[model samples]
Target chain A: MTRPGRDEDPDRLYTVTGGRSRSTTGAETFDLVTLVVSESAPVRGMQSEHAAILRICRFPTAVVELAADLGLPVSVVRILLGDLLAQGKITARHPRRAQTADALPDPDILKQVLVGLRNI
Target chain B: MTSPEISPPPAAGTGRPAAGTAQPVTGTTRPATTGGGTATGTALALLVSVVVASVATLAAVQAGDESARTAIAWGAGAAGAVLCAAVTVAAHARLTNRSLRAALAAGNARAAEREAADNHFADATVPTVVERLRNGGSAETALAEAPPVASEAQRRVLVTLAREVHKGENMRAAAMSACANAAGRVQALATSMAADLREMEHRHADEDVLADLLQLDHRNAQMGRIADSIAVLTGARSGRRWAKPIVMESILRGAMGRIGGYQRVRLHSTSEVAVAGHAAEGVMHLLAELMDNAANFSPPTSEVHVYVEEVAAGVVITVEDGGLVMGEVALRRAEQAVLGEHGDLTALSGTRLGLAVVGRLARKHGLSVSFRPSAHGGTGVLVRIPRELITEARHEERAPAPPPAAGPAPSSPRAPLGAAPGTPPPAAERTRPAADHSRPDTGPPRQAEPVGTAQHDAQGHEQAESGGYATAAPPPQQFGESGLPKRRRGQTLAAVARASATPSRTADSPHGSRSGADGRADDDRAADGRAPAASPKKRPSGARFGDFRRAVQGAGDPEETGQTPLPSASSPTRSSSLSEDDTE
Candidate 1:
């Protein structure tokens, strides 16, 4: 399997594995082992299998951000994003609302500065 | 109880499919009843028997009932009855079933054909509507002309064509290619209209800008005229008597004021000469014009150097700018054009008249104006005026001494300044005599010589001394001395006295001892009997003196003052002596 280029984003990773089985005519002893793979590692598989993994791993971005970053028309981006969503390679989340308590400035400090400036 | 609705079975003669089968009859199959020759022959025989019986009956009716005729009629009646019954039965079968079925099939075919025709009409109607709309028909008219509902195939074609039209395909190309030719024509018309509208808008905007530019031109011309008037007024106010340095500063200030922030850095270099002369005003104006030109042409951050220098014949004022470095030939052409020596002013300023004014004023003042490439890779304007003009003016400023008398000799006696005379001692000697005379005498003491040689030496000494004084004076004096007749000597002397009263050190000396000595020498020469010939020279050519005095007076007067009177003949001759001294 080929590794991703250096410039590729680190957020997404893919891994793949494969095995072949064989049977002996007569066997006196047998052995079994288990192996684990990490998501960041390159796939130790055939090229076609790696390609299939890449096809599955491809994902879509949000329409607005994609349009702005790519300098494409919003209408065009919307259409492309719709197609990607239909392919089920991406997910989206609604943004959360701001808390009212976080938006206000300190009234006491504001009044103090204004009073000091006026006195000067 | 209901009666049975009897109907004959469909004719076996009609070649249709067996009732339940999916396949219809093939073309090879014939009508079963019509193809049976036995059945057709039997029907024909029955028809003939019936007709023969009817004929026998008619014959019997026409003849009386004889034995043979009666017998024939009875037999014919029996046969006719059988035939008539058979014929009637056959005709009833056809009417009841076969003919009715045939009529129903024909009616079904007709209905199907009408339906197909209606569909075709619907397809054709859409194009007709589109064609009408393309030919400048209204949407409502198009809708009225169109069929109420179009077939699915036709609707698909029109929608696809419209989409192509929207994608910027040429209407004519779409028209010739697609089925909806009329729609394409309508699209072309709409596009043409839109393009025409855009062009009209652009033209209108251009016209508006042109109008605004014309208005701006008018305003600029008015402002230019105002600036010219201000320049003239300032020149009149400063006049020729103003200090050269001060006038130069004022000219620079005027240029800066008129051009505002467009002025570049001040010129720090000092000139070889101060531009001191009667033509100072003219020189200032000329410089101002050049500075104005430089300021107008140069970028605001660039530099303009106004340099003044003395050249072989005169003072040169050069204004250099680090902008458009015009070639020497082009600059000359521009200058000549401005001077109106067949040079086109129109070419220089186009419609604005600044350079022309500068050239006119420069020419009026007798200043030589030309242009050359500057050291800083820019155009340089050089204005040179003769140096004699400035020097002559300074000499005329000193006072004139009394004319020498014809008779006696007094030697080694000092007289109060301006009290005795034959021209005042040279202005330079009188002003700073202590400085000059205080130096140890540099030459060997004079040795007595022949009278002619002695006189020649004295005249030569006087000429050299006068030459220095004349150079120190202003320009008008020099010009007048060169041009005027010699009869104005007394006038010249009086004018000189008035000028000396003004601020020079020459008029302040109390001991006028030098003049008296010179006068005493003139008298001694007369007593020696050689003085008569020298007397005419010593009499102080009144005409020359008068001319010099008048020129001085003219210089003193303002430019607006009326002309002064010319000197009388005796004064002219007297003034001629001063002119001769200057020439020498």
Candidate 2:
């Protein structure tokens, strides 16, 4: 593909999918994959296959995991994912689940009551 | 009423008791009063009048029967005597009072004059003293020669005169003392000012020296880079097959080292591939040149993206910066020159040299170069070459094929390239003894001999075309020839000789040498060389232009000696000698 134009925005989100997936209707299921690609964003249209593999492999049962299960070289799978990512055949998730355990603290809870009494 | 002689006067007292009483009263009552003399004189006259009055009274009484007449006579005499006595007393009193008033007035007048003198002295002395001080006279002199007090009018005049004379002396003394004090202050101030000026001068000189030193440092750095690039290229060109890739990598790393981390990251982000070939050295030089331009012109915050992509034809390497966007016209002109437009390459010696180097390198490898606005809004250069050329370059790298050894055999019918187009064969070539001379093998060593001969011929032709070498045409030739072979012997010698001989050529000529020593010679030589060559001949001929172009082209080889000969050749007389040597 030709290099991206200078006018293209670098902040825009892109959807990534495996190249072998021909079904265009499966785009909605991969929405979560698009969210993880937002960090360390590449310049528009210059993203490599490695970035796509990291994005698509976030889901355990994703096409990238399937490719891994089928014994395809992860490098080859990454290149395929980048091509699909550029074609917009898949939709990435809005917010991808965090890979590590949650560490945020819960809110505090307290009760207060007033008793009627005279100065004793 | 008849009395004794002593008692007569007592009776007479009765006769003139009033007059006697008046005399005593006046004398005693007014004795302590002012005009005492007048009072005393009045008292004496009154006493006399009293005595006269008594005598007259007694005489009138003695005349009995003629009492009336006698009384009348006595009365007249007494009255007359009284009148005379009164007039005398009054006159004496008046005279005494007038004398006393005149004496007192005189005393007061003298006192007034003295007071006036004192006042005049007061009014005149201090101001005169001040004036004397003002006029640069000392107080001691003014006081010592204090003006004499004369008449009231003369007093001021004298004080003024004394002040005029003494004031100057006093003022001088005061001023001298003041000036001595002021001189000390002035000396201090002047010393301080001098020190400040010296400090300022030192700082200014320091700044100038620092600027010069920085410029020198920058030039040294540029030379060092050029040297390192040349070393790498020489290593690659020399017969080290494995060392070529390593040298190429080193050159790439060196070029990248010139850039900061941000540029490296940006360069890595773009496509990157390394290609091997004989032109790799040229490519590295071009890369270094381009990177230098980008680093110099681009903002510190910006990144220069370098991409090395392998295409079917050859390798396409591009360096792009998101900084100043050079116009298409400039790019086109640079490209034209790169494509061998045979124009003034000196004009393209600025930033365009980077592109020109790329073009030259591409030409050396039978490649094509194209420049256009990059996808990132900056300039991009694309170099394309045939794969076969790359293979050939690789093969050349594997073997150190000597240039002189690859030519035709010495005994062949083909003429030596060194001979002129239609010239008759040399007597040695035509009538040579075959038995003794087996066509003196023109293989490699013979070919090498002709290289020097070719250069000598070139210089000789240039000299012949330009007439004779001037007296000042040897120094530069000597300098240039020092490190080079004997064929190019008179390079710097001629230049230096010409420069030293013609002292009045131009103010810029002599200074150009020192600057040349400091690396500004490149610019000076280019200008000085081009101006005289085209102007003096009257005709617009590019006679030595080809030689200059060849020299610049050969500059890419790091091991090539006398690569920068423009400074030496710029001297008209020296260049003519160089031209003569070339043509001979």
Model 1 chain B lDDT-worst window of ten: B404-413
Models 1 onward score TM values of: 0.23, 0.23
Judged by lDDT, which candidate is best?
Answer: 2
Angstrom error at residue B71, model 2: 99
Chain B of candidate 2 versus the native chain B: what TM-score? Answer: 0.26
Model 2, residue A105: distance off in Å is 43
Instruction: Report lDDT (CA) for all predictions.
Output: 0.36, 0.37
- In model 2, state the lDDT of residue B415: 15
lDDT of 2: 0.37
How do the residues B96-118 of candidate 2 rate in per-residue lDDT, one tens digit apiece?
A: 55645555575678678879877
Q: How well is each residue in B1-584 modelled by candidate 1, as lDDT tens digits? A: 00011111222232123221212321223234323322344345445645676776767656746657767766667666655555544654443345335445755786787687566655676567556555545555555556654456665655554344333334543443442333334333432332233223212213333234323323332243334433332232222233222223333332333333322635432332333434554555556567767766676678877765657887676788878888768787677655775332235443445566676667667777788887866788887766644432222222221111000011000111211112223333332332232112111211222242233223222322222111212222222555542322332443344333322322233322222222222222222221123122211121122222222222233221112111111122223333233223
